[model samples]
Target: MAEDSGAEKTEQPTPKKLQDAAEKGQIARSKDLGTAFVLIGSAAALLVFGKMLAMAVLTIGQRMLRLDEKDIFETNSMFTAWGDAGGELIMPLIGIFSLILIAAFLGNTLLGGFNLSWQAAGPKASKMDPLKGLKRMFGLQALVELGKSFLKVAVVVGVAFFLLKLFFMDIMALSLMSEPNNIESALYFLGWLFLGLCASTSLIAIVDAPYQKWNHVRQLKMSLQEIKDEHKNSEGSPEIKARIRRTQMQMSMKRMMQQVPTADVIVTNPTHYAVALKYDQGKFRAPVVVAKGVDDIAMHIRKIANGHKIPVIESPALARSIYYTTKLDHPIPEQLFAAVAQVLAYVFQLRLYRKGKGSRPKNLAKELPIPDEFKH
Candidate 1:
């Protein structure tokens, strides 16, 4: 009915749906977050490694200026000098780039928790469809992205202009200072500029990260019919499950009936309950219930016992006690040992009497020693 009515996708996406989307590389991602991390990380790396980088640069300058007249005349000497300068600068450069790379990777993964899918990488025919392409270009999500882009650009440009204006006097003062003083002052201004850029990017990242996550969830929302369909697919339809349970019960009943023939006697509540018991002094310490059931199953057990000429004793208290307290193929409770002993002794005596090996046994007691606890 929900499908016929074209139900709205009001329910949250199920775990399975979320997993499937992630497998297809459809996960929340904010480019602004990554940009923020890269910018912030670049500024930090420069701050930490600034002295080392400055020393390397100074070494390179010193090496070039200290060139002897003989070294200037020789191409091999000049090549060696260049190589030494490059080697001096390599370590600090590697450190800065590595930090930036780590920051970019972390920023991308922090929200979506890192998913890689070859299915997403593979080419699809839908991607080439012009009509779908136009729809995507003008989609609500596309408009949202465009708006974020404009906001980010505006923020970054505005901050850059503000920072430049605030540092105008300092920047002018640097030109008056000589040599290394001007260099240090210039680096200080650059640091503040990097900080401003990082702050602006962070502002966009803060807003975009949560919006991306919310948008991803909205895209994956499930309709009521979809949730029901998924449940049926995963757990099997109710009709099929009921059939499976019925089949299992039938098989179990068949097995129970087979054990009825092996029982020494069938004890019954006359109509409602039945329990078949067997005892062998050499094989068991106590009599065990071979099979048991209630109502229709009780009638079925009695029929099978009659077909096999097994003794059927109408002992309501004993039948109910054994049926309720004992499991199939397990001994009756120790508290009911005296009650069961009486029944077993009578069956043995009756069997001998029917074979003409012994005289007829007297009538068994009507009220057996059923313990209070065992009374059902």
Candidate 2:
């Protein structure tokens, strides 16, 4: 007969799996918007500062050097003019260098703060596959890239055309005017164009920012099959899982054995099962099962009890009841109270016998507390 496969596989993320993937640095990162904002603002400041510095230097040089009509207008003396221009250029170069430094600092700070890593960047089979490369070039990511390019082109063209038409209308109006204030009209038109361009570009940026982020996140999503494959690879194969399970069982047995010495009594099924119960009258109204197991664990429990001089009572039904129903460190249920009481009485009698006193049952007559719902 063919081996039976388990239930139909469905991809679901567990907390452990998510934690493992995060620890392995499988998440994506992007350039921080704050960094871009800082860079752009710094660049604008640098441009203004550069132009101001250039104007100041040029003014100082022209006043100080007093280059006459001979040097200013002579093409042959251009070399002399070039030599003079170099001094004026120094401030602009300084401004540009400062902008670069500021932008680099901002970008580095943003990236450092985010602490991003991509697991896919590590050596991986999929990254090396030709098929994966082809899929990336022709996939949803390609479509998103195409859409982005089209939108950018459309926005730029539309804004440019609108500004050009406005500029043309202002020029036509100025030409029709009886008193053509050429300088005033020109300055007003330039101001309007600058403001319009800034507004239009800002609108595009506002819309594109969120759209670009969504596209990036969508591209990072793993398929159901890919997630399953990753899980299998990271978590180990079925045989390895079985081996891990056996190791865990052994560890659990060891822990259970350690708890046996602390137990007040060992309830047993003679040879098959054992459950250790601990009770502190001030701390607990009823006994708590500390450890319980079957087969080799049961024998281990009995051996530990003997070593500790703790009484072991054989009660097959009580052993099974406590083993199945009570978890480690939980009080036994009221349903098994009567049965457990009898066992405790026998244990107390055994202790009395060992002390060379008349073996008598202490008050086993105390009734177990009835549940609230069962009371009148």
Candidate 3:
């Protein structure tokens, strides 16, 4: 029996089942990837901006502060100049800090769409788990982080060494010249260094972006057991589903009782199943099953049929077939043509039988002709 049951299970999932599973969590959220990119990019931007700001401060102090270049260079006087420059530097530092904060704020808001959950910072019971702590220490995530740090260090060191070599070559070329234009030479060297840095940073960004995205997705992967648990949680357990089915059945029976009053005929397996069918030239080309029920509900359908003066007929095979094959408010199946024709013929005969009249010729044949278009 267990082997038979196992064989009966479907291998493929239904569309509804797949949809229910997907709704369990955001498995493909791009926000996490975007936030990571923003954080890295912002750090790079701030570093570059700080370099530019320091250069600007030096230029301004030389001109606006009117401090002698020799005095600014002397050791004791340099300290005094630096102390005096603090007042001038304060506003620019404040502005730069404000800009950096604004950039960080915008980056987070744009990436994560303004999720302000303070509970994320709160203490959680899950954090107290010893197994979770062990997993954190020796996990795939830790390995990935270690790999990233190693790669970043290697890239930065290699790029810096290459830039140093290029700078040395430029410095050698400058020394060979009879006269070096100090400011122009410095500006040119800075430009080349900036260009090299930009190229190297771009390469790192390109490599890290896809790696971070893949890591984020891997972290969010649902195991087979987790998928099953999520499915059970979202769709409800078997007992709850059974209870819902029972409530739906009770409601269906009540509606069936109401519809029986308007039905033209009630076909039944006597005590087992009942199907109330109705027909009108404008509403239907053929008859429509308006109501159907079984057991105690079938008795209720029969009582309602009798009270409403609708014709009732016993057709055990037809009732059972229709109950299994057709739903409420649907046309009867083509396979039941003969059985349904017989029921309709019996219903027509009721009026003549009630008036003490003789049986009319049966319009329904044993082998009813099937419509050409209806053949499937």
TM-score for each prediction?
Answer: 0.83, 0.48, 0.48
Count of clashing residue pairs in every prediction? 0, 0, 0
List runs of model 2 lying over 4 Å from the truth.
Answer: 1-169, 172-187, 194-228, 233-241, 307-309, 360-376
Mind giving the per-residue lDDT tens digits that candidate 3 earns over 1-376?
3334324322344444434433543222333344444544445444555455555566655745576768767778756666657766666566656655665565445522455344555677888999999999799777866776686677667877888886887766766554225444554666556545545545555565566546544544454455555678878999999999999978876776777898888878789899898877697867788988889889988988888888887766666777777788898876666567767767767667677785664543433344444332
Residue 137 alpha-carbon offset, candidate 3, angstroms? 16
Q: Which candidate is the best by TM-score?
A: 1
Worst 10 residues of 1 by lDDT: 179-188
The most accurate candidate by lDDT is 1
Model 1, 116-135: lDDT tens digits are 99999999999999999999
Model 2 clashing residue pairs (backbone) = none
Model 2, span 302-347: residue lDDT tens:
9989999998877666677788778888999887777777777677
In model 3, what lDDT does residue 328 have? Answer: 87
Q: Which order, best to worst by lDDT?
A: 1, 2, 3
Off by over 4 Å in 3: 1-162, 165-169, 172-189, 197-228, 315-325, 333-376
